[model samples]
Target chain A: MYVAAKGGEKAIRNAHALLAKRRRGNKNLPSISLAQIAQQLTLAVDRVMAEGSLYDVELAALAVKQARGDLIEAIFLIRAFRTTLPRFGYAQALDTSEMLVRRRVSATYKDLPGGQLLGPTFDYTHRLLDTSLGVADEAGEVDDEARQADPADAAPVAMPRVTDLLGQEGLIEAAPADEGAEPFDITRAPVSFPVDRSTRLQTLARGDEGYLLALGYSTQRGYARSHPFVGEIRFGDVEVIFEAPELGFELSLGTVQVTECQSVNQFKGSATTPPQFTRGYGLVFGQCERKALSMALVERALRWKELGEEPGAPAQDEEFVLSHCDNVQATGFVEHLKLPHYVDFQAELDLVRRMRAEQAAERPADGIKEAAE
Target chain B: MALMARAEAGELEAVLAGFAPLPAASDLKPPEVGLVMLRGRTGGDGAPFNLGEATVSRAAVRLEGGASGFAYRLGRDVKAARAAAILDALWQDEARRAEVDAALAPVRARLAAEAAQVRAETAATKVDFFTLVRGED
Candidate 1:
């Protein structure tokens, strides 16, 4: 008895039209430029880029603009764009030690070798939104300082790892990379069960930051706790290097800003290896400190088996965490329910109506409507 | 090969246009262009994070003489993408390399000139920092 509704295409088209109209919002007002989004809404752009698994500011800004400030939608747009691109070759492994340090901090030691630089952080800033920021000129001294690079602002300093001190006494795990091993390309292959550490890390890298943060928070609430110590947290620019086949040598491409965290966790010994502390690492594009730190925590928590610890919680379960980490996939699955389910619902509707009519007939016909029992 | 890094959409198309009597290439895969999310790591040994997305166009073509060419370039320039693919196939055919190179010479020259222009502009603002030795030292 359910009538099939039509005009889905028309509805979608109209909705898109409405969205565009609202996106412009009163044409008299000046439009928001992509450059403005890239510069002003930097955190949003960074998040979109991180989640989208792309790293161009201008394009991210354009995505943000096209998506009308919807971060997830912007990420989707980037993903759609990324789907068609041809693969260039991969680059050599990046070295955090060579990073031109902008912001560096360590929670373990009171003092570090190169010293702690707070840099541009919201840590101490009052959360109160100042009215003055709403105005361009009122924000005080809109200068060229932020636009230009200054060597005098920050020296390229590489601080010694805080774990090195503890490691001297043989108290930390030595996490060595397998040289000359090709990392699993998650993009190229579907997610397999019991994924390798490289794939796990790669998936986690682009995983939703909020979800990871929540998972990390759950760990702090006594869910597979890895009593973490910040060995060093650094934010800075690092040059990209790749082997140029034509040149027959590795050449520097350019530099990109990144945030890295090396979290030293409690020491655990294997049967063969003596008691040594292990480190969870987090590295992300641009200046997303929270994501980086959360990644390290979640990464450390995921290392339960390698360190011989019991996999006790959700975060510890690699399959559960990795599978649910992608927001794009989760969002799509959840949002798909809003689409037409008329035929399926009509079957349920018919069944319910028939049951009701049968019950009515039985009750009216006789008091012989006794329970089956 | 040299143009891969620096060539944008317009320049690539202009260069591709130089091959006026464009050689017919059998479509192995028709050109498909889309944005790709760019990712990077810290210093390079770190967790990968999205830097941003870029438009990338790719095409693969096979020449009549059995040479195959595949091309990949940044941004959404399908014409340029197809041309590059054709040239790539032509390049593989030893007889066509010289002709292709000749056709692309102006494009390279233009790129070099533009690069030089940028260098000139940068040099205009070039500041050389100097060390002043202190008497105490």
Candidate 2:
């Protein structure tokens, strides 16, 4: 029922050539630089970096440019490139308590510590597109007063987390002990059903933002809902420390920008426990507040069993959520349909044709005679 | 080392040029680009988890005088890593340590200025809350 056929080697090469030309839309227009994409299209770079699970800004920018601004394609490129490199070390767990605070806000409390600094967020901005941005000359204009420049002393030198405040009062659940046990590495090992919190968190950290967003949104719509509140959302840079084999002691490996979200969810006390606030954690590379927030929501939803809540929703199903969360794998399987499945399709076609012919033969002159009688 | 890693694209090379006839560094470990898994604690302060991986380039080099040094940074800059490794080797010599510091002074200044700017910008957004009084007040 199946036969092998191969042809289209030259066609594939020519198709790639056409694609390269199409990527550069106009012949006379100036080509975009990697620096420009890294600087100007920063959020795009951040998204690709987050989803790609690779923290190199320059490479993400290059991938974006080469993919012609297709983020998933860019992510695929980064994922492919990541496999070629050897993993040298594991960094000491990031201590975000010492983050050089850029944007810090808490929805649970209004006048909390660090006093809610809004650093370059588009939260309050009207969604309308400014026509000026379309014009090259007008786009360069800067309004000084719009920035609301103030003295340096206004922001406190020591910014603390809102969760720490609630944590102090024993309102929120405490952090688990630092048991020197090694967390399961999602990349190194194949993920199986019913993973630990560490694996689930890692999977969600690099999971497709759009997929997580939808799943998170579903939780809010009462599918295993956990009344969630933004305990704190902060975007800033933290120094990475690594103790490489060559260097025995811990050494600073520069800083990486990250967005961290901690969600406080309402929990009903179980028979053995007292009612208290629970937490959902999310941390991702670069300043990806939206993705971080969505990750937090879904993270809380996924903890249904551990928290003693009934788990029937799709978000609550660890195997279902984790298995389909990775966009690269999802896209690959979905897009593979485009590839030549001639043998597979031909088998189905032949089966259908033979079945129809057999039915016609079986239907015989007796059927016509019976109908006439 | 932080200053060297944080320097601009060509700043390390520019600073290295100052010491024209520098001691050659032999590669103990040639510059290699690789990934370093960046781990994070749950709830921002809990049990550790693998958040993601960052691109890290590392190199180890030994000076002619037997001083070995290493460099690691969170990007794909092999040249920078090698230059930093060489600087590390040079700085191990107490006599040349001051020289390395003096060369990297500009980078220190630049980093300080950038931090101050971020501080000022972030400070501007800090909410200055005022309490609202009742009608009797």
Candidate 3:
């Protein structure tokens, strides 16, 4: 005899308990602290903050630990939490030229003003596993000279950028500024056709990392190849400002670490406009430079509208890329088809039955004609 | 703090009290109502195709509070119109703001409690594991 299933709520509760027990693994062991993860797994924290669109490093670390290192799940958690937070105010537009330089480099020039500072990068390191690091513990020992260094010695010094040099020589086109222009907010409002540059960059910043990476790689493989050279990549902290209603002028709110990228691309002028060099801009929260640089190159490719260039490739088509870029919406729609749809199935069945009966009646007449022949 | 404005309770009551004598939907002469056919496109820039007709109702009213309210309801509802007019008066009257906030207290509390519950349940599942090595000679 068949029995209908019941106790769904109870079953879910029991399953949750089992999952909690499994995650706890050996209760006798010491518990990991949020501080340790924030310090040791800094790169993972950076990725979480970048995708989550949250500036708080500590909160990102907590989400990572809670999600058990599933970056996407952590991002979902952060987004959900962020939605509940009320809109307090808007921050003042940051000036990238005034950024306190930590790590700055340029590919267009071999050497420039305020010489290259390759601070704490793994670019030149060999990809080899070190066996000694597994059991090494040098926690308490500290060098006296390094510890006694003056606090002023560690302060960031302002460095001149390479792109400014090009701007001075008139080699690169002057940066355009529309101070009175309104910027669209992608989070609060739905995306419409012919989006502005700010909204496009916002979408790309929160876009799926893997999807953007593949799209970027396709360009390199000659899909919509635009010759791009890294003008400059800088990482450091910049002050955020917000204007108070009572106060006429803007005031400093706080500071946030950011990575900014500028890419120079070759553009032959159109019939009406003179030929000049163009540029692409990318800015992301936290210490993520490579992704930011890739984003800048892709952004330039998408700027076919303002640049008056022909839309000949995937990168040039704005609607096609932005519409299909979001992972959350894609995952939901794809997965939701698995839910029950008995009524829809019944309607399809009725249509099929009526069509088959008509076909069956015509089959005998066709057979009789063939026999007569 | 500068943006905050004070709203009192008695002023809200007066606004709500004035709305009780408005003409009912059935009593007022029925205005012209019709259905407009909406066209749907196959794709974003594809050819246009006929979808279906949607019923829309619109009404204009002058309140005793010296403010006119214009409403467009998706479906035909006489009671909804009367209620909407009352709401429009309360919205236009700055003095009724405090009373409106007081009326919404219960709903806001419920939503906040529900959000807190969800946060607590999610936080409870978070677990961290670590390994410690003991030194012995």
Candidate 4:
């Protein structure tokens, strides 16, 4: 006597309890620690940070452990936790030109300033999995190369931006001069249509990496057209400067590592702006070179209107791009179907059942009689 | 103010290294750690992306005289943060300004010493690489 009409509250509670128990998993097996997740599953933590839209490593690692390494679930958890916290203030835009670069390479130029130091990249590594990674050996763990400052090339206070060089040669349109206008804070308010440039960038930065990557890939398939070259990509630490109201001065809070990418795209002359190379840009926290590059491509793709060109591609659609970019939002709505939908289901069920009965009563022997006629 | 917090943050542990005179505070916000998404832009004005999360602790307090102060510091030091909020509130008062400065003197001395030590180490390792004059020149 299974009643489809009734709820599964008891079962649901039990399932949740079971989930908690299994998340901790077998007692005999060693339990994974938060620090280990932070250390070993660094990239996974990075994803959670990106999609979760919050940046605490410990908490993101904890979410990873808590969600049993389901990255989307962990991202959801971080987002849920993030909503409860208070925002202090916005940080000043970091100067990536002065980054203490750990890894820097330019596809456009070979012998650029700071030369190419390909620090800690997967580009050179073989794809084969090493079984030795399963075994934990503290001594065998690879350490990050200690950065040496060679006097032959001291890092310039301001590295010559590749785009700036193009601008100087009159090969590209000059960048918009700084108006010191504050960008809209999307976190504090609902995202409005025709959002400011900063708000748009903010949305794309934390957009689902996979989704953005696919969209960026689509551009290469001629969904959108852009002749893009990797002007520069850099990874490194940069100091954070915050202006304190109490002291009436600014101070360096500390440093955080970042990854940045710039894509130079071919452009023809528009009505107002001259024919110069357009720029696509991406910046992210941590070593996310691929994500940054994808973001840059997609960002440029979205900039068709600003460049006075028509935005006809799917990647170019602002509403479509922004709304579905957040992984947490996508997961929540889709996966909420797992929750009890008995009420809605019953409503549809009743309508179907009544319609079937009415049709049976109106017809003679069957639908066969009507068909024969 | 972020600058005040940075200036006081290093000294926070040291300033309250001893006893702190607690100003009357109703915690508008109690000491709590929250995740702040750090964003960076390519070439300063380029596209922005999340760098990662830093653990930040913050506290806000209003003194008896009604000056309100707030502090945000790196990491999960609750007591230090609470003390900083009170110091911020106290330092605002003309009468308490001198007292707050006196209390923070040790923190300043220690930080200055640390900076000097770093400078010395950096100078010790300094190497000047000069291009060799070409034989043609």
Best by TM-score: 2
DockQ of candidate 2 relative to the true structure: 0.65
TM-score of each: 0.71, 0.94, 0.64, 0.77
Candidate 3 C-alpha lDDT tens digits along B1-137: 00001112233244445545543323122332322222211111112222212222333455553454433332234234434444444455577657645654544565445434433332232223334687874
Tens-digit per-residue lDDT, A1-373, candidate 4 = 1124556789989999999999988989999998999988888887787777665677889999999999989988988887776655566678887776666777887655545556556876798877776676553553322333443344243566677677778887655555666556667679879775667778887788899999999887887778789888887767776554545666555566677888889888777767778888877767778888988888888878877766688988888998999898898888877766777888889999999989888875878776888
Instruction: Report every candidate's CA lDDT.
Output: 0.70, 0.87, 0.58, 0.71
Clashes of 3: 0
Indicate which candidate wins on DockQ: 2
Q: Which residue ranges in model 3 land beyond 4 Å of their true spot?
A: A1-7, A137-156, A246-249, A337-373, B1-137
Q: What is the DockQ of each candidate?
A: 0.09, 0.65, 0.01, 0.16
What's the candidate order when arranged by decreasing DockQ? 2, 4, 1, 3
Docking class of 3: incorrect
lDDT of 3 by residue, A1-373 (tens): 1223454788789988987777666799876677888888887787777777766667778888887787877877767666654343444455666665556777777556655556546767797866655667454354534433243433334556665687677666655554444456576678887876666777776666676767766767777776888888877656554453433554443345677788888877778656767777667676777777777777788987677766788876788777776666666677667655556777789999988788768797876787899
- List the candidate numbers ranked by TM-score, top first: 2, 4, 1, 3
lDDT tens digits by residue: candidate 1, B1-137: 54533455566567666766665678886787654434544213434433334455567788775688766554456667777777777778888789778877776787656444433332232233345688985
Q: Summarize candidate 2's per-residue lDDT along A133-193 as a digit string, tens digits.
A: 7776475555644654555474437777778899898888887767999998989999888
**At residue A170, what lDDT does model 3 achieve?**
69
RMSD of each: 9.2, 2.9, 17.9, 7.1
Native-contact recovery for every candidate? 0.10, 0.75, 0.00, 0.17
Worst 10 residues of 4 chain A by lDDT: A143-152
What is the C-alpha lDDT profile of model 1 across A79-189, one tens digit per residue? 777775665556666666676666777777655676666656786688998887777647645443343334432333446656566667777654554455566768877
